[model samples]
Target: MSTRNSLRSAFLQLKRRSSTNTGGVWSDFSKRPTTLKINNAPIRQTLFSEGNSEEGPASLTNGDERLAYHSPIAIDETFQMAYRILEKEANSKYQIVDRLEKSLKNAASQEETIEIKDRIDKNLIEAEIENPEVLYNAEFADSKLLDKSQPVYRHLLKEKWENYDLLVTMQRLEQLHVIPDTLPTLVPKADVKVKFTHNTEDQFSKWVTPGSLLPAFAVSEPPTVYIQEFDRVEGSNNLYTVLLVNPDTPDLATNSFTTTLHYGLKNVMLNNVDNSIDVSKLLKVGPRITFKEYTPLTPEKNAPAQRACLWVFRQSKEIGDISEASENFDIREFAATHGLTPIGAHIWRQKFDRSVPGVRQMYGLGEGRVYEKVRSMDPLNL
Candidate 1:
């Protein structure tokens, strides 16, 4: 279909169900709607003040009669602001405890029940935020294409659900028209394009070509490889393995692969020497891969090292987001090599939620609660 018509149809289809102000079609595709089952969030009232708006209408015969009676306890302003930030990202446990403690007063009166309740609520929000349903995973959402109840499919109807970074299920389905029993393109080629970028100052590209599978086989994700071909010995095929990780940022799921890694495979070299290996038939790319994930405090284990693992992709493109990389993106070929089976929206929905890594090192018990609280209170701020 023509880009304009497909976009128009997507928008019209979405417009039929949702009301949006701008960028309506994209919103409908990527939105994640939170289920509102529990509805009691305490909004602490500030201490009484002169000309307080809490006093209600000016025409009231009595001041107390105009407003509902509030308790005599003074609400902690700093603690309350701290609570606001805490609840915002309740899903992030690591940050939650820190945010909550920031609001705690060194001393408080014993009679303050509300203040105590606030602390308890911190625990409650943490539990709710930990659920995988609160997060949107690409794999899970994709498996649920047929299930109309899923949000990624249903979100295509919401007016405010505009920012979808991943490709739509329908577009992926249409991609099947071109290939058989193969990995479907996750996005339209015209949308995202990837490319190679050189450090202007260095002249040498930072992209790594792998030396051997020993580095890639080290873990499930790719590692860094730091061998350049131009300055290598003769009879060496210049290639390297590239890897990437999720980065563990809230609401961000990242996937990456390398350009090529068949380095020095053309002829057997009895000895290693220092010379430029020409890369005449291979494509070189700079890629970031996730290696070992470490504990938040201890960076030794999983902190990825640059120039680490190098793996091959079905096809290589320059560095960029979806729009720039989509042109050379080869999701179909990558899936076949990576052991990813073709799944529908219904299946992917559950998978996406299940694999969300609810309590990763970056977001632990305390940080999770703060994330949820902050998100619940001010989603736009995220």
Candidate 2:
């Protein structure tokens, strides 16, 4: 009986100590040192601190250290609320834009049209400011957002092309001496890409690189071209001219090189969006755009590699009927006469291959001349 009474007394003492130990578990946690020591140097633990108060917990630092704390749940809720508000605002602005566009189409007078256009522009600006990712995110950019009517979209595409495609094109042109060899110089303002889609099985069916080598059969037919004009004026279309010239056409008699015009197109109307020159485009627009039809380059046997330099020009005005392109053509004189401004250029090299004979026959061209391999003579003794 005495031993049992002693055990009960000990349990009561333990319960009293736990109850008086800084109130409870939370109170004890709050009393913990707000700063820890590493290498005898004090480092404040801000993560577990209280509100953003100038004074820390009374139990730590004698209220000298400032404390900042955040709740994960509160932060998550705040972000979600902000995102919803932004989404609603963006949707409202888009609706306004659509309504304004509809009103613009049915505007009674030029003044009404101008007013609607201004409102649309203002709303578009506000929308972009509120949510820039929709306009600037290239990887996930929507096709509708990339409309030619949107100036922001146009600028984004222009920047992308200038930084990548245009830079590479300029470098290749300089390295290949296509500058002085073809025209005096060029200041490209457009993005031009070419591909041969007639033979889908050919490796060159896709857009050809600036200075890549292509087989004769791959380029035996007309090519599809894309010209993107970034400086396009709103509500106005641009007229472009495309010329394909072979600057490495050998002159057996003169033992020099001469340029030959392989394709010439003029007065092709283009805008930021409708910018492809293909068979379908030609059929829809009629044959008026083609001044000189396409004739693929077929280099003669045992001849040097030929460079097909394609140039894109912005015409000052609509050009009248021009003469047919000649085997020996003067590109500089023609450009000056027609008031053509060089805007972009592309190139692909081709050499005499076994497919050359088959391509020539397919195009109804006569057999190519085979030149004998000439040996270089030894240098004279000093």
Best by TM-score: 2
Model 1 Cα lDDT, one tens digit per residue, 1-382: 4985565445434433432212321112242233312111111111111123345433355757767543232222343344345434543542454455565544266435346435534443453343222222222333222232332223332212224422342333343222222223322211111112322323223322121111211221211222211111222222222222111123311222222111111111111122121222122311222122211111122222212111222122222222213223343454344433222210010011211243233245232212222223233432
> TM-score for all predictions?
0.17, 0.66
lDDT of each: 0.27, 0.71
Give candidate 1 regions above 4 Å deviation: 1-163, 168-181, 184-193, 196-382
Candidate 2 wrong stretches, greater than 4 Å: 1-137, 141-145, 234-237, 375-382
The best candidate by lDDT is 2
How well does model 1 score by local distance difference test? 0.27
**Range of the 10 consecutive residues with the lowest summed lDDT in candidate 2:** 32-41
Model 2 over residues 54-165: C-alpha lDDT tens digits? 3433325544343432123233335434545665675677678888988788999977876787787667656544332333333344432356555445566777888898
